[model samples]
Target: MTTLVKLDHVTRRFGDITALDDVSLEIDSGRIVGLLGPNGAGKTTLLSLVQGLRRASSGTVELFGGSPADARTRRHLGCTPQETALPPTLRVGEVIDFVGAHFDNAVPREELAAEFGISELLKRQTGALSGGQKRRLSVALAFVGRPRLVLLDEPTTGLDVDGRRALWAAVHRQQDAGATVVVTSHYLEEIEALAERVIVIGQGRVLVDDDLSAVLDQVGLRLLRLTTPTPDRVRALTGVVDSRPEHDGSFTFFVQDADVAVAELVRSGIQFSGLTVRGATLEEAFLTLIADSPKQNDAAGVSPRGI
Candidate 1:
């Protein structure tokens, strides 16, 4: 696959703070990439650089094999920020129609409005729409140009479960049409469902970048819950990394190998009603990675401006 976006030794600083430090990354065409991090971890800064909204203090940012500022390159990109920027007095349809005018080839106004279930809202002013409705309209406006690269910052923020599913369907439609999407979201489950690759950032630097499954395997720890009367005895097992007793005579043990630990528990003749093995989810893996890193302390104080 060809590289759609590239950042080389990118550094952005403000006075005593460093928003991005020697960050280098490459995003390929036709893939959904999840850009994840806790607050102030530079996810938004990176996206801004890609959109040419802010320039790197040093180093370079490239889009479609050219500088991000190039008109031809920028025409292929679209962005939806975390906060909506529509004119409050303008009707929903008017906002999209205004933005659509900037693009050489835009999705038909009727078709785009219908796809997001906002055709009825075309006459409603932006301020009159509900939170979820506003979010849907914001998302629809972002895709009006049908650009090859789309950047979404917390796209599903105000959506309910049903609305989230609807947004996901639209995202899938974009992917089918060959668009590369880079999304920043705090919702790990949504990211897992939409992204093939996950990029974790910490302290203004890239911490992990790989296939979502591979990253999970590397960072995910397993837990074994054994329902036994004698919780203290279960805790004494050799392979038990950590154990916590539940109120109902059961103990949950964090372990490296569930198979090896379960066999030992059986061999010891421990009386148990049941046993359940649980794998770490993307959320757990992400939290564990941040908690274990020393840089997490530093990440708390830094904030990127104009995100």
Candidate 2:
């Protein structure tokens, strides 16, 4: 697997504000990578730099072993921004056709439209389409050229559950066809399902870059739901981190060690109707990473409404 993209000590600034600070990362070909972060965390800035939409203030940005601005590199990269601007008067098919023409060898316009369920919408004017339809059309445009690398920013925005599932299928199809995908999404579950590797960003810096499973392991909190009659006794246990009793009399405990905690509960002579332990979810890991960072303090000054 060759390196498809690399950012070496890259930094981007806007006057006194630092959007990215000494960020370094490498993404390989044929892998789906998730670029995740809270608002103002530079996830979009990083993508913009990599796609050549903006220049880095310091260090280097490379795509396909060449500068991002290189024509050859551009041919292999496709970007779907969070907000896509479409010509109001143009029909959906016309927009895709126009974008596809930019590449030397584009995917068939009809095929791309059909893949995203936008075939029926091809004849409709871009402005007349619903938000979900517009989102689908934007995604279709990104796939028009069948580029080796695709960058999707908040791809699932404004999509309902069914629409999101449809988009996920299209993404999986791209991965199956050997394209490298970099997605930044607000939906943690979507990232967990689509990305093999996860990169978390905070304060314009990389917080964690590793296999999804490995990153989850670092945040080792588990939720244990038990149907014990002695909920009070379980709450009294010293090892239990936090315990809350449900209306149904069941107790759910947040614990650091499931095996040891359960053993202790059993030894306390409590009979449980059921005991289940669930590992930390990607959402839990994401929140933990952001909360633990010193940058969280800076977030306070950015207006409470925005934070």
Candidate 3:
């Protein structure tokens, strides 16, 4: 696949603050990438540099094999920022037409609106639209130019469950039609649902970058829940990562393998009940990554509250 964007040891700073560290990455063509991070993790700064909204303090940022700040690069780059400022007087269809006019090969206004589930809102003025409606329109506008690379920052910010699903479907359609998309969100479910590849960012650095499955596997955290009299015994067992005592006389054990842990529990004759074993979710994997990056957190002055 082609390389649509590449950052070579890039660093961006605001006078005294370094928003992005010496980071390097590559986004290839046709990949759905999720940029996951907590507040002040430099997610927005990284996207801004890519969109040519800001220049890197040092190093290089390239789009289509050229500087991201170039007109040609901007032409092929479409971005929907977290906060959108649309012309209040412009009707939805008019906004679409106006944006589409900038590109030589734009998706038809009606088609774009319908794909994003905003067909009925075509005639409504931007100012009169609800928060969710405006959000949908903002995301749809990114595809008005038939962009090859689209950056969506919190695209489903104010959307309900159904609306969010519709937006996800629209994004899937865009990816299927050959658009490389990068989405950043506070919602882990959105990232898990939309991203094939996941990048975990923390303290202005890339903590984890891999296939979504690989990330979860790397953490290798499984949970075994059971009512036990002695939580310390469970914690001391080999292969058990950690054990926490719950209020209801149950212990939750983090383990590498659930079956092995259960076998050990049975072999020890530990008098346990209400056994339940389950795999870790993305949230658990994320917490594991953060816990392992204490040095990075310190250097970046990141307190637990920051996350």
**Candidate No. with top lDDT:** 3
Please give the distance, in angstroms, between residue 264's alpha carbon in candidate 2 and its true position after superposition: 11
Q: Cα lDDT of all candidates, in order?
A: 0.81, 0.81, 0.84
Listed in order, each prediction's TM-score against the native is 0.81, 0.80, 0.83
Model 2 Cα lDDT, one tens digit per residue, 25-51: 999987799988878989999999888
Best by TM-score: 3
**Per-prediction RMSD in angstroms?**
5.5, 5.5, 4.1
- Over the stretch 59-177, how does candidate 3's per-residue lDDT look in tens digits? 99999899877777778888883435988999999988988888889989888988888899999999999989999999998988888999999889878999999899999999998
Weakest lDDT window of 10 consecutive positions for candidate 2: 298-307
Candidate 3 to native Cα RMSD, angstroms: 4.1
Error of 1 at 48 (Å): 0.8
> Quick one: ranking by lDDT, best first?
3, 2, 1
Pairs clashing within candidate 1? none
Which regions of candidate 3 are displaced past 4 Å? Answer: 225-253, 259-276, 295-307
- lDDT score of model 3? 0.84
